[model samples]
Target: AQSVTQPDARVTVSEGASLQLRCKYSSSVTPYLFWYVQYPRQGLQLLLKYYSGDPVVQGVNGFEAEFSKSNSSFHLRKASVHWSDSAVYFCAGQNTGGADRLTFGKGTQLIIQP
Candidate 1:
């Protein structure tokens, strides 16, 4: 079985500050790592994904993540976040085959302080 752990359940950041969200995963084989962001009452949007090749992957909205095989971790980072960036962030993993469903962490709620 595959699973993911998000250390922090919530994070608060003032506007214009950098943000880093941690994610740890456990899988039998190389997992397809992904970061998704969700606005209130909205579906999740793909932030970034690390399938293979490069260890680092970039996503929309100035977000990026680095995949560490040894540590089994994929962390999301944003250089500067705006008020609009305040949303729920989720760390997800999928098996190599598409048959398996995506496993997501509880999620990290981001609160932006004006």
Candidate 2:
């Protein structure tokens, strides 16, 4: 079984500033990972996913994540954040060891400071 963790429960950034939400995994095997965001009163929306090849993967809304097998990390980044980008971001992973159930991180709440 594999698990993910977001070290910061909340992150604050100025409007139009760059942002990065970190996600670290605890497993010898690199699990397939995905980043999701949840807006107020809305279900989670998939931002990006990584399985193989291409260490960097692009996501919606000017977001991207780089996968590092050595560090066991998949940190999500955005060049600039908008007010609407305020949301709870989650990192999830699925172990390739047969069980397809997804393990999710605690989530980080992104606050856009005006």
Candidate 3:
């Protein structure tokens, strides 16, 4: 089974500032990774995903992530964030088999400061 860990349970960043949310994964083999964000009382939205292409992948809303197999990480980053970016971010992955369901992290809550 694969798993993901979010070291920081919460991250506070001022509006219009850059942001980075760390995520580490553990797996027996290379897996498909993804980043998702959830707003209050809303369903999760896909931020980005990594299958087997470039290490860096761009996502919606000016978000991006770099897949680092050597480090066992797929961290999310944004050049700038707004109050609208405040949400819970989850790192999830599934084995290459594709039959197995995705394993998600505990999630990191991003707090936007005024």
For lDDT, the strongest prediction is: 2
The lDDT values for all models are 0.89, 0.92, 0.90
What would the TM-score be for candidate 2 when compared with the true structure? 0.93
State the lDDT of candidate 2 residue by residue for 22-63, as single tens digits.
999988334689999999999999999999999999999899
Question: RMSD in angstroms, candidate 1?
Answer: 1.8
In candidate 2, list every pair of residues with a backbone clash.
Answer: none
Please give, for residues 1-114, the per-residue lDDT of candidate 1 as tens digits.
Answer: 437888899999988899999999987434698999999999999999888999989999899999998999999999988999989999998855667778898999999898
> Could you say which candidate leads in TM-score?
2
Residue-by-residue lDDT tens digits, candidate 3, 70-94: 8999999999899999999999988
For model 1, what is the error of residue 3's alpha carbon versus the real structure, in angstroms, after optimal superposition? 1.1
Report how far residue 110 has shifted in candidate 1, in Å: 0.8
- Regarding lDDT, does 1 or 2 come out ahead? 2
- Predicted structure 3, TM vs. truth: 0.92
- All candidates: TM-score: 0.91, 0.93, 0.92
Evaluate model 2: give its lDDT. 0.92
